[model samples]
Target: MTKGRRRTTRDADHESFDTAYDAIMARWPDGTESLTVPTPYGPTRVHACGPRGAPPLVLLPGGGATSAGWYALAAELSKTHRVFAVDLVGDAGHSAPDPQRPVRSVGDLTAWLDALLDGLSIGLPSGPPVDLCGHSYGAWIALHYALHAPTRVRRTVLLDPTGCFAGFRASYLLRALPMLLRPSARRVRRFLEWETAGGAPLDPALLRLQERAAVLPAVRPVTGPRPDPAALRGLRCPVLLLLAGDGRAHDPHRVAARASAVLPEVTATVLPGVSHHVLPYAMHADVHGRTAAFLGPLSRPSR
Candidate 1:
């Protein structure tokens, strides 16, 4: 690579963004390997750790947080499973989307995950059912995917999932609109600060990356009607739903009650004092301990 050539502004911005992203990823456990797997929608980037033969656990991060945001959670899960934290296509992070085959619908997003799992050699004939974990928007993806392919997912963990058991609060959406419609670093910081509401402080590196990503071009996230309550009842895989007591996204108690009633097998717990956006990284020890206990020991040694 030559360093003397003048770079375009977009190129420089991407480089700077990558630098900020890497700074946060530095917290990942030792020997974490970055892998790029080809999918029809795009080449997916995954941060993987854990033993080769352990049960596979796929992690999906919230919108804009990227796979790097799961460093803390991934480290703990890696102890018992072969953890693969994915950089969702069409979102922030190293994953690139092929404009020709954009993810335009929830179905397309699920198909992308199908291809990604195949590329990663997880699920179906290639390997055993995976343990899926997600946060916020990522949790929605995880839940949808579990419903989309129940046979392939052994268990699921959702951290303050939005749009699963309840809808977002009107106030939360109003606060987020400015950041969504016309993003700026200031808006990003303000939205997070407001949502986190003085909970445990967010990681400085991840916060910097979020601010940098605010202005980056992003494909509109695929959105649709929430999964039907009947469908939720039919999902056979056990689920662990962790809610934030102070979360303003939706009424956590309502979410818990609805989820407990609708989900055939679910354990819903609300962590007091935490807020929505910060739940993933804020309550590290509690999240890890609860998640590990729910997923249980690996089923069998990886073959």
Candidate 2:
């Protein structure tokens, strides 16, 4: 409706939404407790797991990816840290779609997140702001939130974040252009295939579910603005940037060098031979390990 992607009409919204929501919930790792946190935009869905008292870590998925996308990583990381994987509002997920208040700017994006955090008791006297981990588009959101609301964040982990350091490659835009122009289950599958081409094959079942959701008519999702250089250079909290060597999403060397030079406290690591599809064995292990260490008590606020 908005571009190449087919927007699911109101008539078909219920059936399609139920199926996609169920599939996402079914695939979640054991012990994940699903909850809906109310926000001004709508009710946001989150998958919470791990010890209640442990330091909290919020997981945000990439463009068109669901909370299920974080299932594997969350399952592994939850052993030490409480993990909450959210289906970003306005995306094709259980989170209620809101075309009315679309997150077109950094202010809009951060406002919705601030409301969601308040709903989750983050930054309150009893609840402290948690660490953030974002992939692709979600990484963009995490970065903005950290810049705009530094006091609420402990640290951040960005995995293959596109658009922060630079723009998407021409090839990426070309491949994605089709889906935005003429969205179909087939094109969605094709895009997934291309994204997972080298690193690791995404879970087949998850891909199938996403394909269905993509074809269903739904509200177009948010497209965040590119980060400003001044904000990127003035981050208050520490951050960990994980780049894949062969990933087309962003230029690894350039992003790392910029992060080292611009950011106050950052650890940049480039995993050799890893692709943009980071959920695979090697990428997941390295990214998760580094994130866990970064999210450890050592990084917590000074009491």
Candidate 3:
């Protein structure tokens, strides 16, 4: 691949996106309103479910995951909170992809989200402080937002956040090293299967999205050794950390212990036998109940 050369999606990619979009939309509640929030780089797509007047809550999926990654579980989430599921930019969702200017810094990602919330009127000025939840890569993103933009966030939920408390396993790096050096369709499929072995097959759109992400020359902006103990200590809002038992991405138990010690207001839960990829989707009702209990009900500000 040439340095200046950009990777454009072929026709097959379009087909995959179309197929996944239909499947994803079918899973959403009957009248989900889709909105496009404009950003400096481009537009981001947000899928709103539940009552419009309900407390605004944002849901962010893991890296290479589309907005619908939360489809199987969004229903339960929307029951108590107005869920604003986001199709993060630079990923395979309907949002625009700017490979030439990949979000490389945390500030860039934060500002992108700031514009999104402002566009949706999802915070104190408009209503109430937004509640944020993220899984895997998204958990790291959510944590960053809470730390840097404290005023905008209320309660936060981090589920098996990658790179926050612990780094990726050496085994994962070793297994993925070959794909990094020479990414191919077959390798991508194999990696996906490995990550989601017990779970169901990913929607075609997300599969295609991950395929493109695997070969991208530039890296997406990600959370580094962030939300460190110092940052965690400063957070005024409560944080819920859900750990996946026997997780390979990070040591869940270790993270739970560390977070408990450093954060003033934090709760930790470890789900037995669950892995990194198998998240709230695997136990929708259980996760939903816990999330609702932790967050309680939304309280809009008075006029």
Candidate 4:
């Protein structure tokens, strides 16, 4: 009888885990159009814009960026495609706790994304295969997802991807060391000027937004796995890789060549005189127009 009671308690504990996982998955910002889809890992949040009936394009933001990061891109893409920007789980923004015990390694990241897509009902018999666009670390996620779930991905665009270039390493010290030493407005202004290279001036409000984002509690160090050349070579989907030619750390031409050499089908473009941060703003209109043209002829026919 004691053994039986212990077995019952164990079952109860397992049930508790399931319940907590479910609750965490379901917790998302209220009033936003959200879907809680179950993945192998955990539930994921999918935020959308544009008509539901249109073809789907998934947007993956850079590290520490939430789904809101793709606001401008989504607004532009939504004219033709149903845009869904996903907040990567276990990172900043609104995403459920990872289902896997200890979310480390490239395989784990791929599995987490697979679970996210499953949870969101992203690709299925009724829905169109996804067209994915990812920026920076998000690009790495998109690339792995395509490799793991090729059938579910129709086309992929990697915007200012991080792992492709050895030189483009983003250092915490580069951003943090200065802030720690000089938190004054003058220092911040100087930093901003240096960061932007006195190019187009950023709106004061936009600068404030960047500042607030920097201070978010969830923003922390992220260690990324090295790129797998073999895996990249194996990808069969159509790919578009965009790089900013004038990015401080990344060499756009070299990175583009490396990506093009590995990906089976690829087109690489470099926007001259643009930095990593300014790419979205400087090349926004052009990229949007070009992307629309690229996807228009290729996207699956409406049912």
* lDDT of candidates 1 onward, in order: 0.88, 0.76, 0.75, 0.65
Q: What lDDT tens digits, residue by residue, belong to model 4 across residues 136-186?
A: 788877887888788888888888887754545465238635754545445
User: Which tens-of-lDDT digit does each residue in 113-218 have in candidate 1?
Assistant: 9999888888866668899999999999999999998888989999999878788999999999999989988999999888887676767788889998987899
lDDT of 2 by residue, 1-303 (tens): 356776557436557656766765675567789899988777899889988878778888887777776766777778887888888887767888565665666687789888987887765446676788988888889998898888788888988788788777888788889988888879988876886677655666677667767765555655655777787777778889988877776578888887788788899998766777554224366776877777777634432
Candidate 3 weakest ten by summed lDDT: 212-221
Q: Stretches of candidate 3 above 4 Å error? A: 1-9, 97-102, 196-219, 298-303
lDDT of 2 at 35: 91
Single out the weakest 10-residue window by summed lDDT for candidate 1: 294-303
lDDT of 4: 0.65
Worst 10 residues of 4 by lDDT: 23-32
Task: Give every collision pair in model 3.
Answer: none
TM-score of 1: 0.95
In model 3, the number of clashes is 0
* Model 3: per-residue Cα lDDT over 145-216, one tens digit each: 898888889899988888777677787777666766787656877776676565444455556556655544
Show the lowest summed lDDT stretch of 10 residues, model 2. Answer: 276-285
Candidate of highest lDDT: 1
